[model samples]
Target: MAQGPPPPSTPVELLTNKGIIEEPFVNKFWGPALFGTFTFIGVCVSNWFTRRPVFAGIQKHIILSGTAAVIGKFVDDYRAGYLAERDAVLRHYIELHPADFPPFERKKFADVLEPWVPIR
Candidate 1:
């Protein structure tokens, strides 16, 4: 009996079927904020051990943490906005030139496209 075509094989089949993993929201903001807070606390403790005023530097720690949080938020927002813009552009292009994309794949991109908003 003739067997059908051999099943596909990979040189390293162990790596196949791996799925994408997303990062947690905490890593984007709280992680950086905590790191900054701890670093500033260490500095304050060091100053206290050296007979320097520790309270004077408390505001600095708060500012550093806030800054880190703000920066993290900005980075996250920018990334999301960038991806939205990219999808919008791609959808527009696909709509304008339907023949360029395969029919089977067009349905996957059928979601309503987001309007492009220029960054101020």
Candidate 2:
């Protein structure tokens, strides 16, 4: 005898895949799918608006994108509490290795980011 495959990522995903969490609906499957689908639709809508008046719809897209990012972030944070935990671990690591990470200098900002910017 042998195993077939690995397990699912999250508890909700696992339950939904196995047909265990079948009641009214499958929250795990629908939640991310709907969120991503709507987010992409929102971008398309913004693009549609943008085509009408050159750069007029740009600001709308920016705001909408920002809103989507914030909402998605909030959902992930609420679900996993990753931010605080990662911050705590990072803080501890920094404390343990103060010499490895140097303090930021305002003068070096341009030097740090200039290469990434396009030439033209």
Candidate 3:
């Protein structure tokens, strides 16, 4: 009996195959987890600064990436004409049911408030 090729004996492979972990965890929640943790820390620090005002000017920086992602998606969708098409559908519905969507008469609050002025 000639020796066959050695079986795959990597420690990680053995542990995984032996049910230590069926599959490794691919962490997709790191961003949200880190954000929440940092936010909690910021709140704690703010509490610590009770004697003086806590001026964290970089608050927006925390959410800037997510905000930009949303804005980018919106712009891309608009450029693709999806937004225009959706708006057109909404307009068509409003036109179809004019009673439900009353047309706006362009008049200022001043016109309503000043009865002394001549009604033009």
Candidate 4:
């Protein structure tokens, strides 16, 4: 009998199926996962340095930028459904820690952040 094409046999093999590669990588949480992890680590290091009197040059901009990056990842993942579970957890935490978030104030960030974050 003639041999048919070999069947996909690995976890990665499923990616070869149609509509896999073409789909958004965020749906798999790869992009947000990497960005959030790196941003969090950098934020912690920057905050540590901020406490020292020697590194006066390391402005609070690091924390601001790092937070923006993390939020950006959350928005990206939420829109991608990668954060569906994550969002629930965050929402729960935020609910418990009401002081962490600011009142909903619209800002120019919506111009960029909105595009990345879908209305859901």
Candidate 5:
């Protein structure tokens, strides 16, 4: 009897249903859980060496991490708002004065404005 078609040659084509099922769970939960556990252990050990109580060290870690997270969120929001305003202004200007931008420049702006395009 003839054999089935050759197995997938490339890594991308070789993925199985099990791999797909595990990928998201590993990415969304396992990675962060591992990192947080390691960080907590490191902080506790460092505090112990410094002669600080374990609970107090944990409290400090929580407070500092919370403050940092809030500050990071505010910064992210500000950056997003700034980028939106800038893109709007650029698009409006392009619309008002199409002659000012050549086709190449227009393409550049389009790429830059695209949300999926990474900033260099």
Candidate 6:
């Protein structure tokens, strides 16, 4: 049987339909959003202090935008490094202990990681 389109619904349903509700909030924020926000704020403060009087406005905007771009690229590279390193470790451990390691898509987990992981 052919299924009809979903009916108009409440706010939650609307959000779900738009994919906002279904999207993982933490995952979304971790990758680029959080990094970008931190970079923007950091650049703004630094530029505010260091910028010359006449060119301060233009410099501030340029600095913030540039910081975000540079930081975002750094974050991407950092994440790729972490993924490669983590996967290597996991593979090594699994090779040492076959019984403990279950076969699965290790790359999937690696791909979902953020640039910064606290080592403690």
Write down the RMSD of all candidates, one decimal each: 16.8, 21.0, 27.4, 19.8, 15.7, 16.2
Clashes of 5: 0
What's the residue-level lDDT of 85 in candidate 4?
Answer: 59
Cα lDDT of model 6 by residue, 42-107, tens digit: 666766677744335766666666667667767777886797677666656656776664444325
Model 4 per-residue lDDT at 112 = 52
Q: Would you list the C-alpha lDDT of every candidate in the order shown?
A: 0.62, 0.57, 0.51, 0.57, 0.56, 0.59
Alpha-carbon shift of residue 68 in model 3 (angstroms): 14
List pairs with backbone clashes in candidate 2.
Answer: none
**For all candidates, what are the clash counts?**
0, 0, 0, 0, 0, 0
lDDT of 2: 0.57
**lDDT (tens digit, per residue) of candidate 5 on 14-61:** 322334333344433443445455556667777888898765656767
lDDT, residue 44, model 6: 61
Candidate 2 lDDT, 1-120, residue by residue in tens:
866445554322322335443435554445455565576567776666767643355666567656765676568557655755665677667667768766543445676665666668
What lDDT does model 3 reach?
A: 0.51
At residue 35, give the lDDT of candidate 3: 51
Preferred candidate (lDDT higher): 1 or 4 = 1
The parts of candidate 5 lying over 4 Å away from their true place are 1-56, 104-120
Measured on C-alpha atoms, candidate 1 has an lDDT of 0.62
Between which residue pairs do clashes occur in model 3?
none
- Poorly placed runs, candidate 3 (over 4 Å): 1-79, 111-120
lDDT of 1 by residue, 64-120 (tens): 767766766677678777976776676667667766654332223447577689999
Taking all chains together, the TM-score of candidate 6 against the true structure is 0.39
Cα lDDT of model 4 by residue, 39-101, tens digit: 656666766777844334444545655676677667775675664555566666666766766
